[model samples]
Target chain A: MPAPRPDGACRDEELLAAVILRLIAGLRHVAVGAQSPIPATAALLARHLGKGQPFVSLLSSARHNFFTDGGRELFDCAGQGRVDAFFLSGGQIDGAANINLVAIGDYAAPQVRFPGSFGSAYLYYVVPRVILFRLEHSRRTLVNKVDFISAPGTSPPGVYRPGGPVALVTNRCVFAFDRQRGRFRLESLHPGHTLEEVLDHTGFDFDRPERVPQTPSPSPEHLDLMRGVVAPLLAEVYPQFAATVFGFTRQEQS
Target chain B: MSAIFRSLDEALAGIGDGAMLVVPPEYGGVAMEATRALIRRGLRDLHLVTLPASSLQADLLIGAGAVATIETSAVSLGEFGPAPRFAAAVTSGKIRIKDATCPAIHAALQAAEKGVPFMPLRGLVGSDLVARRPDWRVIDNPFAARDPIVLLPAIRPDVALFHAPMADRNGNVWIGRRRELATMAHAAAKTVVTVERIHDGDLLATEASAAGVLPALYVEAVAAAPRGAWPLPLAGEYPRDEAHCAEYARLAATEEGFRRYLDRYVYARAAA
Candidate 1:
């Protein structure tokens, strides 16, 4: 019998990273903003796989980021079509692709107010591909409609929107957004999650195939690269995340 | 153009009630010491703008009742969790919120820097924030056939306040590669800066330093406040006091606890 994959094996975060890495393929530039550990990991991994073809920019790092002008430069780059892909998360995301990063409940008196929108509204419109990621996949997060639209999923015709939501990745499943149809189509279900559970937990309606497929797990080689290679790169900006996700500790090089 | 001041209090002078103030994010050189000084001054009704987003500074000011209205994209405690005071005040209708997206704030400030009435942006076409924001308008792109774009009014603040790694005798602050500080200074009527220390010579004299210098032309005042960006980071300089931040997150979870936090950290330290 084949031996199990070594001491540092895959976890949910690693799986999510692999999924995001696949989604970001063929992009020239993938930029990750503050506090997004998974996307940052995926971007770094993609760079490693692409042999530095697609440049990765982690907004939190001083060394990795080439933008001399600070956070504003990131917006400028996105507006100029220099950024290819970006990641956005929300307190609540509706089926129509609307994301609520503002508050939940009422606008006047919210029960919960998330960290204000972090350039998602602008990046959603400018970046060619914007991937919506939320680790928690439940009715509360995946809602029928967001309380306050921090960034709408779709825009009116003839608007100068070169970008919008492309796909949403959650713990339970993956959904590809149809910009023309203004709805999501279920692509695949993650392992250990069922269609019924996804339907039960999801608050929004989406199209789906009669026979859904399971999200493929990362191969042993991919897992090795992620833990050994990408994890160290991630430590530059997100040390805590790298430590927590892959048991990666910064090592002193000779 | 000797903008040097002896104290944070003196540097922050001239900023009175109802003045519009702009600041940077936690990592991008936030003036935490200056912010505390402002809080201690018992300032009121200030219009505070976070360049795009804020963390502790906004919440601290809002909690202290120093802010009347805030115009920014978002505020949170980051990894520590949601900002308690900001959430409470917003939910209780204590402060007026001008919810913005990240780039919108940058674009508006850019407009102010260029002395323009407004700047047209590509996004916010169908956002509810667009519908709610009476100030932001959607107009046909003048150059395009039928393309609609969002136009944000200029955000010309009365003062732009921040902390930096160093400043020189000529009042030129070396902000390094964090150029948003320069943008803020250009957009505001006056700019107040607090630095870790004074550089021995003119920052603009050296080519390496000149690239990162916010010239004295835009600076109104400067003060030396070492570790000015404490509890937060100064980009390439120091890491945040993470343990303190975590403790702050733990204590600032409730109104009473936040009050105690103010008494212990902000008020008590100032008195000491």
Candidate 2:
């Protein structure tokens, strides 16, 4: 086997995608929503890796999407338990894994209103594995408690919930959410990020081991597939992301 | 009887101020031309419901003060960025926002289409969306043992409006595979359509075309409005005007810039 290359060779986006691919491991069907290039890349990579033969569906892409009923079909499939894994992000995320995608202040007159909840409230309850991802790991983003609960991380005891948050991946570290305990345990810190930095920047508290492991970088082969094969596929939908991250030429994209 | 109308303005005449209007997505078939006409006519206080989500159509309307309340899953510019006018309005509490998830909106509209009082759905039981919405109720499943589910009230709109690539002389609009528009027409009290062109023959005469045709029964008024979904795509017919959208997003970021955009695009288009 070839010697492991320096982590600097890999881009931050590629690393995040690799991290997400690990979290979504063993899932059969993974659906990604609009404006989520990192999750889209990870889903595509999972298909490329040929591990579980997970079927990837990117909603924004015309080629990858198989739904005929417009936007409603995705929700309908999620409702019937057809979708196995999905991704979500929020303007604010708390220790309990609750997300806030709506307004920041008063509901009537908000100081900051993120786009109203799309399908997060519904999909969060149905997709067996909902991976919460936020690239920015800061005090403002990872709050002690969200201003509004777009989707609560945990359901009541009697509620028939098949899905909830399984893991949270951010630029600083990875957090594993315990549904029963309703708390997050720090899983691993990303390379080049210090534990102290995460602690200072994070607004919410979480459990962590004495010794935290560094997040593993993507294998050279995985990087190759991501840049060469998956990048082109993603370019079909997220052209701008593909161009910026993988340096895909305009001629090649078209 | 045929449902054809002589003018676009006349076709949209039934959709007055404060009417609840249901429409499809930006790409599928959004009546952008009609939205501009409404702006031109100075229509106000309308309740706009995007079937699941919207793009520039909702933002443009809200920016123009044509909408008083918006009920939908989301309103985003897509690729361009967060919809500026929409974010501005929401932050300032200019218009009421009934925040909904995609499935809830679809389920409620489905109930309306089926003439049902309400529809039970899974997955909303633990969500804050359930607690916030008075129209949505959590009820125990009647048949299932010790089961709880969310029941959303039917969303019956006053007018279902959209643009299509073509409509036959019989007023059956060709929507291809985008069936949500048909559902919107079925759910709303009145349905008005604008098409790029009118096909000469009957759309439902052939097996292949029948699947694509939204039958004339649901469509009350049809007008020939070429390039109706400009600056936005109409599925297989035309592509989105990305440059125009970017310009709009850039200009609409600020209050002063948004007014300039209104002057240049919305008002100028109306004048033209």
| Candidate 1: regions farther than 4 A off | A1-9, A249-254, B1-3, B270-272
Q: Pick the candidate with the highest lDDT.
A: 1
Clash pairs, model 2 backbone: none
Model 2, span B179-216: residue lDDT tens: 88888888999999999998989999999999888998
| lDDT, residue A117, candidate 1 | 81
CA lDDT, candidate 1, residue B189: 97
* Top candidate by TM-score: 1
Error of 1 at A12 (Å): 1.6
lDDT tens readout by residue for model 1, B55-167: 99999999999999999888988767788889888988999999998888988999999999999887888887888799999888788799888899999999999999998
lDDT for position A95 in model 1 = 97
For A58-169, candidate 1 gives per-residue lDDT tens digits of 8878767878777788888998999999999999999998999999988778887777888987899889899999999999999998898988898877777888889999
Docking class of 2: medium
